[model samples]
Target: MAIAWSGSLDFTVERSGKSLMGSAVSGEGLVNVYQGSGKVLLAPVG
Candidate 1:
């Protein structure tokens, strides 16, 4: 099953030698994720 979440996150995904690497942050000034499996991250738009 897929979970849904909403919040503000600063994430960056990039390719590193044929691999993908990135960082994501949540709960920063109304940034939160709900109903997510933790691995899944969702951000809100205004």
Candidate 2:
């Protein structure tokens, strides 16, 4: 069998059986992914 990421691609962990809320992008090339504990990321992808 092939393995998959098969997981939530959010920046946080939430109830409702672990759900993702929303995402945002700023002019400074910052993306904020919200779920439980929100995250801020830069365009300088790692």
Candidate 3:
């Protein structure tokens, strides 16, 4: 989840090489990338 406090915020998901380093890492080989100006709040859930 993401929240833009002010200005603008862009969120994107791309392939993560670091996450694919190990087979038992338990990741989907993807990462969330947040860019742009202003303050952004990010929340991660399990």
Question: What is the Å distance of residue 35 in model 3 from its true position?
Answer: 1.1
Q: After superposition, how far is residue 39 of candidate 1 from its true place, in Å?
A: 6.9
Model 3 misplacement above 4 A:
1-7, 18-28, 43-46
Best candidate per lDDT, number? 3
TM-score of each: 0.18, 0.17, 0.46
Please, what are the lDDT tens digits per residue for candidate 3 over residues 3-46? 44445767688776654565236565666777877787667866
Winner by TM-score: 3
- Report the error of model 1 at residue 42, Å: 9.7
**In model 1, what is the error at residue 40, expressed in angstroms?**
2.3
Q: Give lDDT tens digits, candidate 2, residues 17-37.
A: 222332222223233335444
Q: Is candidate 1 or candidate 2 better by TM-score?
A: 1
lDDT of 3: 0.65
Question: How far off is residue 29 in model 2, in Å?
Answer: 0.4
Give the alpha carbon lDDT tens digit for every residue of 1-46 in model 1: 2234334433333333332222223222222323423355346665
Q: In model 1, what is the error at residue 13, expressed in angstroms? A: 2.1
TM for candidate 1 is 0.18
Every model's Cα RMSD, please? 12.1, 12.0, 3.8
